[model samples]
Target: MRDRLRATLALVVVGLLAAACSTGGGDKGFTGTRLETPYQAADIALTDTSGLPFSLVEDTDKPLTLVFFGYTHCPDFCPLVLNNIAAGINMLDDDESAKVDVVLVTTDPTRDDEKAMRAYLDGYNKSFIGLTGDLDTVIEVGEPLHVYVNDGKKLPSGGYDLGGHSTFTLGLDDSAEAVALWNQETSAKEFAADIRTLLTDD
Candidate 1:
């Protein structure tokens, strides 16, 4: 088990390197430059769960995005994190709000089509975007984000577990570079506050 986990981590790291080098991204238009990304990424293209082309190069022109990785079938963490996003977005000031986006990217592409993703996110806020693509493209996004979703299978009782996942959420600059990352546990209020600071700064 330990060896398997290590191998998985290694694979993620390698994938991240690939992502960092292959993207053709440019700068986001944020006058406030106080926040800097803790990690940098090579601009990459990823389709949202809605099957729309969402490229880092194109979309970063807007406000910062709070990106989270999870699947539709995830019974708990997925929804919980999204709810936090909704709450946080609601808390932003008008000007600050204009500079923030909340997006959900799915790890399970096979089961999470655009319709499925849309339905899942509808429970939270219709404005929240759900992104998914082919398994290969999905990996391209997850690797750079460093998210891992475990295998899912039928349990003895018949209700299959959607596999455990390492929770990953990040705040990104217009350049899609990671400015702040919140792992398994981080407060929504704090995340909201930090985003406001980033949005309002010059």
Candidate 2:
């Protein structure tokens, strides 16, 4: 079992390397960059804050699905990314807002309980969905998305420390195909514009 797990993790690392070097980001006016090879959305199972079984394919209800991976305890990037997303979503009219769904998957499942996840997300947008599960399960879902998650540091106290993660948000079209990616610098208005293009472009 240990060998298998290590092998799987090795493959994930290789995939991340390849993805990082690929020449994607080709769009003209997108706030988020475009990937030359838009990854096919991976359908992994996890539990939502509401205790319901969730999978990417089943949970994505709109034409555009935005997926982010990070922990609630993250003192910087995570909240900033979500806040940007919420702002982007708010920029849309009712019709446009209804066309998108934003999801956050926790990297620090050890400390991020349902209550914490719910409260953190509610501060940004009530409609945003938060997902958490066992460590292995979260890694399985995150790996294909090129989200690197660490178990975190150990504190002098009994509690575990917060970990780090890749701070990019992925955008997927209705076909469940990855279409765009946004880095920490992306603005809400730019994100909204890219989303609109993704929903309409061929």
Best by TM-score: 2
Per-model TM-score versus the true fold: 0.70, 0.80
> Candidate 1 on 1-202: residue-level lDDT in tens?
8655765575455445434543224334321122232555446667765567886556666658877777777677777777777777778777777777778776777777788888888888777777776655655665555443433333343222333334656667777776655543445685677676677656
Candidate 1, residue 68: the lDDT equals 76
The Cα error of candidate 2 at residue 130, in Å, is: 0.2
Q: Which candidate is the best by lDDT?
A: 2
Report the Cα lDDT for candidate 2: 0.74
Q: Backbone clash tally for model 1?
A: 6
- Per-residue accuracy of model 2 over 1-202 as CA lDDT, tens digit each: 7644664565455446545744644555755656677777668889898999998876786789899887777777777878889998999889988889999888777778788899999999999999988877877876666665543343342222223325678887777766677776678888888888877876
Worst 10 residues of 2 by lDDT: 156-165
lDDT to native, each model: 0.62, 0.74
